[model samples]
Target: MTSAPPTETARNDDQAPPPEQPAGRRAAPSPVWPGLRALAGLLRPQRGRLLAGIALGLLGSLLGLAQPMAAKHVMDSVGQGQPAVGSVVLLSTLVLAGGLLAGLGHYVLDCSAESVVCTARRRLTHRLPRLRVPVIEHTEPGDLIARVTSDTALLRRTAPQAASAAVTGTLITVATVVMMGLLDAVLLCVTLTVVAFVGLVVILVTPHIGRATRHTQEAVGRMGAGLERTLGALRTVKAAGAEQRETAALHRAAEYARRAGVRAAAWEAVSTTLSAVVLQACFLAVLGVGGARVTSGSIGVSTLVAFLLYLFALAPRVGQLVEGVGQLQIGAAAAVRLREAEALEVEEAESTEPDRPEGDGDETAPAPEQAPGSHERHRHPAAVAFQQVHFTYRPGLPPVHRHVSFTVPAGGMTAIVGPSGAGKTTVFALIERFYEPDAGRVLLDGRDVRRWPLARLRAAIGYVEQDPTVLAGTLRDNLTLGAADATDEQIAQVLRLARLDTMTGRLPHGLDTQVGHRGSRLSGGERQRVAIARALLRRPRLLLLDEATSQLDAANEAALRETITDTARRTTVLVVAHRLSTVTTADRILVMEAGRVRARGTHAELMARDSLYAELASTQLIAFR
Candidate 1:
């Protein structure tokens, strides 16, 4: 009995479905100089504030330089028996003012750095969807995620902390060195040599930093992938009682990440400690030489005291330079890994126009055709055909499929049945162009399947895999997914035909009911019916059903069988059958064994001739024969 259509039900009577989540985001690496050049533009908007902040920082450092000098002035005044109250007041005020300026500079630079990172993330996120699918398939999801989450954060720190520190470090180092030179040129010369040696140490270490940091990031990506796999298969792990094995696997992955991180941290610690040691050595040298000069009256006590103050003033910048170099290595390493991911090759686009057959200028020439219909009607040049196809997953391994040849007539129910390793699924994979055949020509509608635009070709057929992936959405949305603009009456007709609407009447929202993640909310039979309804909406000329009704109970199985039989009369249906009950009623059966077609006949005919078919039918058919 045909029921009233779902559209007859009122709108706004059901709960609205959740919107689909946007795809994951990834970070892109910028070319070294070009990325830096783009970064400079981010500073332009706040240039006035930046200049003001930088000026303040310099003033602060200068006042800080004056504090010890002022102490020396007080010391000299006391020795000469003069009042030093005015010198003390001036030094204290300079110290207070410099502190405020330094604080303001840091705030401005930090704000600018955040703005730069935000701009970079927005641009990269926008570019991701436009990238070709093949490139995305080849990349690791965890690696891409790390670029957006971790790598971008690292860059944010680099902009303000590393860049600004290096600048301030430079100005202070130069100013302090000059002040020391005024006191005694020999001591200043020794200090300059130590600073140069520290720079050499940093430069030698920086290159290693980039390589080590990249390895660490890669290890982290691998660990994330392992964790994701374990979580996704949580149910399987629990049922198989393999929790211990899974835990061990994850621990191994985490250990790899730890090793990489340790290597990077080791280099960073050594570089930082060595720089501090270098600065302290300079401090000792300045004190020793200046003390001797003061004793000989070559330099005054006040001059020697001021020189010692200058040495301490230079320390932060020297340390900052060391830290900045270390950060540069990390950024470089991350950039290289990101670049490696981005550089994967994409599948070449199909040509819009194919070359004509040689010596065939006629538009309607009768091409070499297949056998005239014996039991077939309206043969239509074999909807799909495989010629001389030979495929192997890897070189030197035995071929999974060898020299297979067949023609599937358009517009009928054809069933392919086989044992476990008969390569039944590989045939479907080739038809869908998932993996290119090593040596074969797969023809669809009389032309090479690869020649067709990937989107256009896929749209022509409706495919339901063995384990149908049901995305989270409303029951109505799943039915109308392939044809969103389908009319309410047409949608209702399909739902009833697929037997999904029978369950919908029991649902609170009928067709508008929400199916949870992966359609886990729906029973197995309901999910299969929903998938059938979805394919029916497309009105596809070719329907590829892989174990389409395998999950149904006895009552639901009968309903699905009726639906498949009814649809077969109007469209071509190809199904992979594991149960003999399904194929016994099929119009024709192709028995596959060892990747080759062993027999082709109606059920009774195959049972009479083929021992494999006879044995399989008796055991698995459930008396349907």
Candidate 2:
């Protein structure tokens, strides 16, 4: 009979790796321009602040350019044996002012960087919830998380460096060169030759650095995925005694990241060391060539001192220019990854129906609402139907649901039972509209689900997945996740109904006690009950529970099962179960096989009429268990 599927991460990672990762081609890494465009788009919203920062940096660079002139004046005064106090004071003031401007400029840029990261993160969070289920199925959660965390961080840190390099650094380098030429054109030629050669060397080495950085980041993402996979199944790994094997695999991923980092560092080292060495060589060459000019009276001593000071100024500028290019490269790569993640298809705003003509029919025309007080129940309930629905997790794969069709009336318990991989759980997936059917319609309350406002459709139903998920939070937080405005009485009521009142008494902080990561601190049965209580609190018209009672002990399962039967008196309930004992009391039981609904009847009816159901009842499940 049907069982809950394995952990979602394991199923996704094992069966369908992401195209953006190792599978390759479907979402290949974008070329240079697209990444740059993505980076530009991220910065565009912050242009006002970013530009203000750049203006400050430019002003600072101009101030720094004037310092050499101020120093030259001081030198000239000293050489002439005149009072140099005024010149010295000018140089000191320029130094202090330049420092202040630079600090202010960097501060503005950092704030803009932080704002960009914040915006990118918000966009990711918004899109992620609405992404079509298949995209998430194919991709690694850890890698997606890396894009939100690591990639945005890269964008923030490198973006500021790029801005300063492109503007202030280049402008300073050019202005310094102009001043050097004014001092002595002949000596300027020697300095330019050394700088130009080293500049070409750095340029030649930079593309390699960029490629290495991209590889390193990709490796880091893979390592994160591996770690997440392990941590997510920590208990299973420990029970299986496979910790060494898992650790060794993670080590391999880490080693790959380390090697990629080493390659990036080597290229960076070459660029930086060459830049430093060339500056020293330029100083020596200018000293050698300009001394000859001094002997020949081509320039004054003050002019030589000033030219050398300009070269000193050029050192930081040239380094900035080189470093900026590298940061741009790194930022561009991170931007590409971020863009890929953001590009994943998001569910459109499904809460609003399109505007219609005054005479147009109602969107949920003749909505199939339950008759007022028509049943033994005395509350709201949803009607659900599937009509010839077909679906697959991915294209080119065999369909999970083939010509599947079923229906349930309002305010009763309905159960789907079948062997494993028989598409039982997929029924819940379709009802929730997590994945669209390749053919036919899924109707909720007599309206095609696609035609219903997505939010309205979902709000009417509560679904618990095959694997009960309990996020790290307080016990109360987990209980109230679906119903934020739930009153304390409502919480207390469900806690008692789900047999959790006893559990709370043992908790150190009762409802306020922290549920460890994924509720790791809770037993499997405790987590399942917490999930059930959360769903009940939503007060949904339709409640779908897949393997809802799988984790519970026989005693607790029997208790919860009675609660479910009572809940069906007032609301629609659908369950997927492997144990026949749980569903024998259901108002209707569906028998599914090989993606098709083979039969439908109560336990007694099926036992009398169908061999497959009889065989299943007799051998597949213990009838008296």
Overall lDDT per candidate, in order of appearance: 0.69, 0.80
Segments of candidate 2 deviating more than 4 angstroms: 3-30, 351-378, 620-625
- Candidate 2's TM-score reads 0.92
Q: Tens-digit lDDT track for model 2 on 296-407?
A: 9888888988998898888888988888877887888888888888888877655323444545323433333432212321257877888889876666666678889888
Off by over 4 Å in 1: 1-184, 291-310, 349-382, 472-494, 502-517, 608-611, 621-625
Q: Note the residue pairs that clash in candidate 2.
A: none
| TM-score for all models, in order of appearance | 0.73, 0.92
Error of 1 at 287 (Å): 3.4
lDDT of 2 at 504: 98
What digit string (tens of lDDT, one per residue) describes model 1 on residues 1-625?
0000011111111111222221222433334544444445544555665566667677777778777778888899989999989988887898888898888888876776677567656655655544553345445555566766666677667645555666677777787777778777987898899999998988788666655666677677776766766766577789999999999988998899899899888888888888899989888888887788888889898887777777777777788778876775565555454444344444445533466676532233224332221122223323677787876544564665677777777666888876655667667767766656788677765566676666555656677766666778888878888777789999889878887766888999987889977787888777887888888787776688877887888788888888888778777788887677788888888877666778888999998999887877877843221
User: Which 10-residue window of candidate 2 scores lowest in summed lDDT?
Assistant: 9-18
RMSD of each: 10.2, 3.8
Report how far residue 611 has shifted in candidate 1, in Å.
4.2
Q: How many backbone clashes does candidate 2 have?
A: 0
TM-score of 1: 0.73
